[model samples]
Target: MQAYRIVRDDLTQPAVLALLQFHLDEMNRWSPADKVHAMAAERLRAPDVTFFSAWDGAALASVGALRDLGAGRGELKSMRSAPDYRGRGAGRAMLDRLLDEARARGMTWLGLETGRPQAFRDAHALYAANGFAECAPFGDYVSDDFSLCMERGL
Candidate 1:
């Protein structure tokens, strides 16, 4: 069995950087440059963003972040499970960790934006399965058929 666990990450290690790059590259393929909203790995180290990595022993299983959006709101950011680790519960573990952290930090809401293409179908299902329902755009986003915004109260 995989000894997988989630840990607070600083986003500076080579493996973590690779995961962030992978996520960004994938986003670039499916989203227009103008619509890409994922923060760079270095940028995620800013004070407001809490980044986490799911690890299976020494291997990186997945990475995700929670950005403090102020007003007791948080945004789920950069949810990416490494391809090699998909279907092994890494994604779910990372998400649940973020959600638990949000509640622990007193966030009243959590929101996220994801692409509408087939690349994101599994992601949409994961979010919905975890109580995140589709909602109107939040933050600086506008309504977009190519983008799907979802949120849930914390």
Candidate 2:
């Protein structure tokens, strides 16, 4: 397996911010503005959210976050791989780290919201391959044509 460090990363770096903005912009393009569930940068830094960036050597390869939703539930948020590193293992590594974190925290379930545009097919496959299943909306989310809700029990 490829080796990369998944570290607790802050959004202070310009590159990180720019990459995250690109992720959000892509989401905006795929889904309606009202249906985009990506967390704002500031909110990603909140106490309940654990944000991480994957680093290969000195390069930031990807970013992801896990948010505690109380009562043993967790949510995956803001997963994005650097454009140059898209085909690499960054996304898988970040996801494994988040799953580890959630399991360590004794979370019973994990869930996420992702856009359903054709652009998101790879992401849909990734989540499904990782054991997520399509389900009704959870938490504050509502049914929407442009969004998909998925969950897996830990």
Candidate 3:
């Protein structure tokens, strides 16, 4: 599989939106008020956000975003793999590419907020496997039982 990092407009609108909505639907199954859908949509339209898509042949396998927080800090936002692509390491591959891009841009730290509900156990394990450690909340997120904050210093 090859991964592509493209300008926002380079993405096919329906495909990208479908990926985002799928993630939102998955999250909503557990946390109804996560509000990540709106936030991701807004960020996807922002110039400061870098979005990447991983493709297997011509099929979109995963999507991930990295937002510049200024001062050498970056935030990971809206990372998900298509349902048919799960369990195939697409998420991990996409995350590794995002990390490389962030470091290339001179980011000193990477932070992300993820759901902490039982439904998110696999996600939590993914982050932990990549060296992200639990940390205090970052970005616009407040401390909540349903969410967790994690960071990895570059």
Candidate 4:
């Protein structure tokens, strides 16, 4: 695995914005609009959300965020790896950073809502490998055909 420098991002950099847009576009392409749960750049800038980007030297490799859901709970948001960075451990590195941040913040659980389509198969496997399991709808989400919710104890 290549070394990745993971750090908190303000979501204002052009590369970060572009990657986030790509992530939203891909999510929309793979799932219905109503079922798409990826947050926009503005939403990710909220005080409770800590956005992170992983870089390989000067190039942005991946992006993710952890949102405080209150009561010792947190949620993973906007996880995406650049096309050239996929399969290169950048995403996993970003996930590890987010999990570490969650634990540091005293979160007892971390959950995420992702697509159920085949396009998201790899994402499911990655989350599962990291100890997340399919769980009931969480937060404002409800049981849905196109959404898969997963959670892990911190």
RMSD per model, one decimal: 1.3, 1.1, 2.5, 0.8
State in Å the error of residue 51, model 2.
0.3
For model 1, residues 1-154, the per-residue Cα lDDT tens digits are: 3557888998878999998998999888889888899889878999999999999888999999999999999999999999998888889988989999999999999999988889889999999999999899998886587888999997
Candidate 4 local lDDT, 32-101, one digit each (tens): 8788888999999999999999999999999999999999999999999999999999989999999999
For model 3, residues 1-154, the per-residue Cα lDDT tens digits are: 4454333334456777788887877777767575443345655768888888887776777888888999999988888888888878888888898899899999999999887778778888999999999999887776677778899998
Give each model's clash number.
Answer: 0, 0, 0, 0
Q: What overall lDDT goes with each candidate model?
A: 0.91, 0.90, 0.79, 0.93
> How should the candidates be ordered by lDDT, best one leading?
4, 1, 2, 3
Worst 10 residues of 4 by lDDT: 139-148
RMSD of 2: 1.1
Whichever of 2 and 3 has more TM-score, that candidate is 2
What TM-score would each prediction reach against the true structure? Answer: 0.96, 0.95, 0.87, 0.97
- Judged by TM-score relative to the true structure, which candidate is superior, 3 or 4? 4
lDDT of 2 by residue, 64-117 (tens): 999999999999999999998887888999999999999999999999988777
By the lDDT metric, which is better: model 2 or model 3? 2
Question: In candidate 2, which residue pairs get closer than 3 Å at backbone N, Cα or C atoms, i.e. clash?
Answer: none
Task: Give the clashing residue pairs of candidate 3, or none.
Answer: none
